[model samples]
Each structure stands twice: as C-alpha cells, then as structure tokens.
Target: MSGLLIGYARVSTDEQDLTAQRDALTTLGVAPERIYVDHGLTGTNRARPGLREAMAACRGGDVLVVTKLDRLARSLPDARDIVAELTAREVKLSLGGSVHDPTDPVGRLLFNVLAMVAEFESDLIKMRTREGMKVARAKGRLRGKKPKLSPRQESHLVELHHAGAHTSAELAELFSVARSTVYRAIERARPAAPSAS
Candidate 1:
C-alpha cells in the first residue's frame, strides 16, 4: 500500500482493445505511465515482455492492479507461481477494487479457490471440444485441413516412392509440401498387415 500502484493490462489479439482495462486502472489512481500492457498476446503466453517488465518493476509494498483475475493469468499453476513471486517481493495483487495480500492466509485461500475454478472451467471446455470432435468424426464431418496434394498426385507419388525412383525429400519438393507430408501419404497408402491367428 505504501509503494507505487503499478498496473498491468493484456489483450489476446490485435483486434481486441485494452481501453476498458486502461480506464479502470486509471480510475484506480494508477498513473498512466506506471501501467504495462501486453497487446496482441494471450494470457497463456508466459513469455510476454510487458508482463515480465511489470513483475520486475514490482518491489516491497508495491501493489499490482489488474481489471480482472483472468487478465493476469490463465491457469492455476501459473496463478500460484505469480502469487508466490509477488509474495516473495511483499507485493499485493489488487483485482478490480479488492486487494489480495499473498502473505495473509485468507487472501491466499481466495486466490487458490479462484485459480482452481479457472482450471476447472478450462478442463470443461477441453472435454466439450473433444466430444464435439468425436461427433463430427462419426458424421464424416471432422476431416481436418484439406491435403495439399490431390488423390491422383498422391497415387503417382506413392508409385514413384515404391519404385524407389525418388527420395521423400524429392517428392516433397516436387509436390510443394513438407517432407513429413510425403511420409504420411506413403504410410496411408501401405496395406495394413494381416493379423496372425
């Protein structure tokens, strides 16, 4: 509470705006110059330069303010690591108007609860996505990106490969694709081995 009120803001994409977060921080008496921003970067991206600078700028009694908890971190472990760092430096994290002192048991508990909720929400999203993908696959609608090579070209490529006339690299260069693509096409063309009784 005694040190400077440092603020951090982030937006996930270039199209998103940070105006609301900036205004909120400004309203909280955080000086415009003291605010750090990581524009066009995801909260999941831990190597954000602005975030690193903001953490490094924090010192004893300093308060790090964010408009929301999600704006600060994306996962429970990430949140806990950040809290630990701030605690070690004796810095407080102020979410909106509520100040969380990591040194205090109540504040630590609250932070952990919120982080767990965030992690739970992320897991639900992943599970739902997997289910959706499964359904799409069953319906023959889950085909991924279209192959760079056509079936005719693939057949020709496979024929050439079996004849040992061209290397995988050569086929990839001729087909204008990555060498891995050539390998995958060859693998798919191979007949499945007959199961032994």
Candidate 2:
C-alpha cells in the first residue's frame, strides 16, 4: 500500500552532524517536515523523544524509514520490538536500501532469532554483574559506589527495622538518611533462605 514516507534520524551529540542521515532520508523522498530528529541522545537508550513521536505518528499503511537499522535502534531486541509493533499495526518499517521485510516469513524468522540473541546478551550482562558482585563480596569490598550512609548507620537501620520500633520513613528522618536508603537496608537485611528439601 502507498503510505506516508516518514523518516527518523538521531545523532548522539550536538557536536555530531545529522548530514548523513538527513541526506539519506532526503534521497528516499521523505519530506523535511516529516523527518523526525533527536540530537544528543545515546543509542543505548530507547526512550528517544523524537523517535517516540515518530512512532506515535505512524498508523495503518504508514512507512517508517531510517538510514539504517543502527540508526533506528541500539540493539537487536529494540529493532525487533519496533518492527513487530509496526507490523502489528499494519505499518511498514524499512531502512533506506534494505530488502529485508519483516512482513516476509523469512524476515520474521530472522527477526525472532536476532531478538533471542539480544535477550541472551542481556542475560549475559546480568550474569556478569552477579559474578562481579560475587567476586566483590569475596573481597569484602562489593566494588561499587558505596552506600550513602556509613555501615554503622545502615546496620542500625536494619536493626531498627527488624525490631519494628521505627518505620522506614521514621528511620530515615531519625538517622538523617534518605527514605530509599532505609528501604534498601531493610531489603539487604531481609531473610532470603534457600529452599528446604
């Protein structure tokens, strides 16, 4: 179906030029007004304001264009999620010269596989973080930005929370601590017993 040729462009910093992306979309016949641009946003974040606007502006029979897949999203899951949503809503998403069509059976299968790989990568990040924490714990350092409160204060908070003598808010106020700190302390102190056979 013939649809509006809407384009999205992003540059990580104000210092970076959007010339490449802009020229690409221009070549694709996307109007200047229909081109959405976000400046100074890192690709690691999917919450781009202009990108969100472009997605919201899309409707059935609309075509979303980007210079490339990387310009559209930072990761496989991000690409797949956006493509899936567009496909679901009867919108078509394409990079300027890509023959890959998510609506095609093969493309859909490939998208699913890529999405799984992205999920695995995310799991790997978590596993590495847990392992890092384990090593840090073993070293008695935890290798992170330390707590805002001193260990003694946090220990006191946990004790008070356990004794049920003070609510978290009260503890925070009494100890000159943030409410979040008191809550976190309680969580750290809460029992997490292993499953009994």
TM-score of 1: 0.62
Candidate 2 clashes between residue pairs 3 or more apart in a chain or in different chains: none
Model 2 lDDT per residue over 44-119, tens place: 5799999999999888988898886666776776787788788898888766745358758987786567556655
Give TM-scores for every candidate, taking all chains together and pairing residue i with residue i: 0.62, 0.54
Candidate 1 lDDT, 1-197, residue by residue in tens: 37999999999789999899999999998999999999998666789998999999999999999988778887888988998889888898999979987768998899888878767766776789899999989998889887788999988888888878899999999999999999988888878312210
Supply candidate 1's per-residue lDDT for 135.
Answer: 96
- C-alpha positional error of residue 94 in candidate 2 after TM-score superposition, expressed in Å: 1.2
Per-model RMSD to reference: 8.4, 11.7
Where's the lowest-lDDT run of ten residues in candidate 1? 188-197
lDDT of 2 at 192: 34
